[model samples]
Target: MYPRLFTAAAFCLIAVASSKAEEDSHAIFRRAEAPKEVRAAVTCDEADDIITRDAFAGGWLWQSKCPSNHANFIKAQIFSRDKNGKDAKLIRFPVPRGTPLEEISNVEFFPATREFNSLFVNPEDESVCRTEARWIAQNALKPKLVFWRETKDCDGKKGWRVLKGRK
Candidate 1:
């Protein structure tokens, strides 16, 4: 009787431990099965140029306009694969402020010049400022403005519109 009782207790403990382990494994698998979001703002065709496998290389260029300034510009170049398989983009301008805020009045893309130009109007006062032509490398994901400068005439902060690549 005593031996039978001991064996039953041991079996019960083993069964409980096995059940806990299975539950833990299921939890871990569930977490691992979740999907991840990819960060690609523009399609391949939207890029300035797309290179096939072994054609040239995978990379991209990004550009952003400065606030209130017509001539100043920011640009960056991003590579598809790093030396160690790490994908990264190099930022040319290191502005603390992210992207300028302006209501884009007009946008123009010059194929000959390979430049993107636009005119932005302040959302608050409607003050107009021209964004000079700037060239961005092809393949960049989403180039965000990191810094900005305010024009003497347009000193107020307002929203900005992106006019690049707009038809």
Candidate 2:
């Protein structure tokens, strides 16, 4: 009887931990609940979520989901300061049409390198394709495209290509 009780307690503890882990993994902001600047900068009619908002070089970087024409899409915008350190016009990037939101949703920032990175996996078959991209934010408002690599045949031995800058 004591052993059974111990096992039940342990299971309950594990369940609680698993629930917390999932909750912590996805920290998102609904469009309306986002900051005023974020709402103003976002042009979509209704955005489902704001996945990332990080301080970049001299400004901020934003990534959000905007659904339009029955299609879910992701958008990116950067804001930098002007000569007097006031907010300047937002710079919008046309995230390639049809690019899966999963590709850019979880943006990772590296303070030391001042770079943002993203990983992409084929939704249909995760093991068959993968892509990674990195962007460097400098003194200017524009984030420079650093590298974009993809492996169509995620096999351990093939299909690695550098589509843009160095990897």
Candidate 3:
């Protein structure tokens, strides 16, 4: 019985490893990971990287997003440079994760400048049937987390329209 159990466990581990490899290869699917753990779902070129202008400050914000499918977490890699324009530091901010299509979230930078972390829209908790997203504005002097106005679709999809860009 012990040998059989060991064999079964080994098989399960191999199967899990193979499945994870498959997900890694596929473009749409990403190996499920918890929030704050960084993983790339798509290639760097496919990532919607917002390059900040030199007028304000030279830096870039790469929001890890697929052109087609949206991931659970707002895995954004931000870089805020010094005046010299050298590689200052890489500030990676991962927003709270949400359920796959049922509960969606989005993040938009204010002024679209070379600054890090403006605002983010996400459900307070993914497990519950919440309507509004927790709109957090870090750019303001006193950062506040508020709920966005809710909108219901014909298909019973509750979504919050925070920023006026992207789906």
Best by lDDT: 2
Candidate 1 ranges beyond 4 A from true positions: 1-96, 100-105, 123-133, 138-167
- lDDT tens digits by residue: candidate 3, 1-167: 99999999999999999988655432322223211222322233334432222222233222354342332333333233332223323333223343222112344444333223332233443434233333232432122334333333322256554432234
The residue-by-residue lDDT of candidate 1 on 64-153, one tens digit each, is: 222333433222122334322144333332223355322222344332333334333343544444232243324233333322333324
Worst 10 residues of 3 by lDDT: 33-42
TM-score for each candidate, following the candidate numbering: 0.24, 0.51, 0.27
Q: Judged by TM-score, which candidate is best?
A: 2
Off by over 4 Å in 2: 1-30, 43-52, 66-77, 80-103, 123-128, 154-157
Ranking by lDDT: 2, 3, 1
- C-alpha RMSD by candidate, in order: 18.3, 10.0, 17.4
> All models: lDDT?
0.32, 0.54, 0.35
Which residue pairs overlap in candidate 3's backbone?
none
Q: How many steric overlaps are in each model, in order?
A: 13, 0, 0
- List model 2 lDDT by residue over 30-121, tens digit each: 65665666556555544555545554554545556554322223354535343221353354322333432222433576645777676655
Instruction: Please give the RMSD of candidate 2 to the true structure.
Output: 10.0
How many angstroms is residue 42 displaced in model 3 relative to the true structure, after the best TM-score fit?
Answer: 12
